[model samples]
Target: GAGVSQTPSNKVTEKGKYVELRCDPISGHTALYWYRQSLGQGPEFLIYFQGTGAADDSGLPNDRFFAVRPEGSVSTLKIQRTERGDSAVYLCASSLIGHRGELFFGEGSRLTVL
Candidate 1:
């Protein structure tokens, strides 16, 4: 029963570069979600996937952000043309299903755009 995990717990990047963050969800969990949390703020939903298709991606900020969950397991968030405003903690969570279930979050990938 591996819990969700994220890599590069901290990342520092330039304002216009691209970066990719990885997440590994728990086994047997079919619902995966990505969220962003700025300092002193609650997590804001970014995207979610059920199986291989993105069930909800309404929270993605703009075209600069995108994510994919292939094989219904591991997921990755990709950011293009990063900006200082994009600096935040990107969190990944997963649950058995999308509903009122509780979401287990990873330590998060902290992105700092300079």
Candidate 2:
């Protein structure tokens, strides 16, 4: 893809359900990130992947959230036991390895826990 791509632009589920969000980054980009944005706040970092491994996942709120970039090109965020408080827009961004500040972001997958 020429830019970052995310699937399921809008997802609404009852609380306690499991959800998965996908992100396909720009070709050749070596860094990918997951972020969550609540109603009016800025995107909050959830995880960062460098190639096939996650270099930082400390920002994830709890054990229920996890992410994987198996081949270093596409990533998926998995949420277990979703809660209403988890409703937010999940954003994905990618950039060249050395260019952390220049990220290309996807439109985001909005998850609404009902």
Candidate 3:
């Protein structure tokens, strides 16, 4: 019954800390996604999952970022050695199908790196 959900509504960290962002998608939805939004920009596609596997992960900027959807219902985004440039609103979304269905999006986790 729940829509997409994300944890740690806000986080502030030093530049070198590691962070893990979590998302819980709507039950039975097979498409889950992670996106990032910086300041005034629209959310940028980071990665997407169809069922239990990552279908697209090309949007990740570099090796510091990774995501997983092991059971097709929940996913996590991991960032290593975070930088001030990494500060942004990390959003999660889900749909019934891959990239074509109505997307249900989460409120997003705001990360601030100092």
Candidate 4:
């Protein structure tokens, strides 16, 4: 079984740009979550999807951030009008529901806004 993986482990972009971070979750897992972690801080929940629908997205900072899990598996985080404050590690995790699960995190997509 494959663990979650993220692309562009590092990304640098200017202010007011757009960026998309991809995440590949573990096979057969139906629960996917996205979290943003700043330096020396715990991961802040961004969005969580159970199956093909987003169960919780209140953690998304603003409209600039959005995510989707069309096939109930892989997901992507899209950020528009990127700002320096958006610089952080975007982590993706997946787990088995109701199984006393622990989220398995990806290396993370580190975004740098300059």
Candidate 5:
């Protein structure tokens, strides 16, 4: 892929349901990150993975949110016990290791929990 790719551009789920959003980054990029954006706010960092290990996950709101990068090229964000307040655009970005400034973003997967 020439750029980041996110699956299911829009997802609508009922409250208490579980959802998994996937991201496939550009080939060979090593750093991947997940962010969330609400109605009027900018993208908020959720997690970051360096290779197959999570380097930072402090931005995740709570235990219901989790993400994994198993092979270092693709990642999945899992949301458990979803709530109406969790509706937002989940953004995935990637860049070459040590080149955070060159980040590339995917068309976020918009999660609408009703």
Candidate 6:
């Protein structure tokens, strides 16, 4: 089966603009997660969804950041009023079930807010 996939590998946007990053998980994966990685830092958790419902969303910095996994296979991370500080690589990962299983991550969508 295919691994996770993210679209628009790179994105350049001006401050205050909005952007959407998409991720497609592997077949049969029920656990999906979103993470963000800034320069010189490890990827930080953003959101996690079990099936079609988000189970955890505490990592979202603010209301401006949101995500959805309506079909349990694909997810979209939406950013509103983006700022220069928001520039980073958004990563998506998927797993079969609980944390005990292996997590496969996408190459990541790099967003650069100028």
TM-score of each: 0.97, 0.97, 0.96, 0.95, 0.96, 0.97
**Tens digit of per-residue lDDT, candidate 4, span 49-114:** 999899989999999999999999889999999999999999999988812588888999999999
Pairs that clash in candidate 6: none
**1-114 per-residue lDDT for model 1 (tens digits):** 468889989999999999999999998889999999999999999999998899989999999999999899999999999999999999999998675698999999999999
**Per-residue accuracy of model 3 over 1-114 as CA lDDT, tens digit each:** 567889988999999999999999899999998999998999999999999888899999999999988877889999999999999999999998878888899999999999
TM-score winner between 4 and 5, please give it: 5
Q: List the residue pairs that clash in candidate 3.
A: none
Per-model C-alpha lDDT, please?
0.94, 0.94, 0.92, 0.92, 0.93, 0.94
Model 3: runs farther than 4 Å from truth? none
**lDDT score for residue 87 of model 2:** 98
Writing each residue's lDDT as its tens digit, candidate 5 over 35-76 gives 999989999999999898889999999999999988877999
lDDT of 2 by residue, 1-114 (tens): 778999989999999999999999999999999999998999999999999999999899999999999998999999999999999999999989634469999999999999
Candidate 6 global lDDT: 0.94
After superposition, which runs of candidate 4 have C-alpha atoms over 4 Å from their true positions? 98-100
Q: State the displacement of the C-alpha of residue 64, model 4, in Å, after optimal TM-score superposition.
A: 0.6
TM-score of 1: 0.97
Misplaced by over 4 Å in model 5 are none
Clashing residue pairs, backbone N/CA/C < 3 A, model 4: none
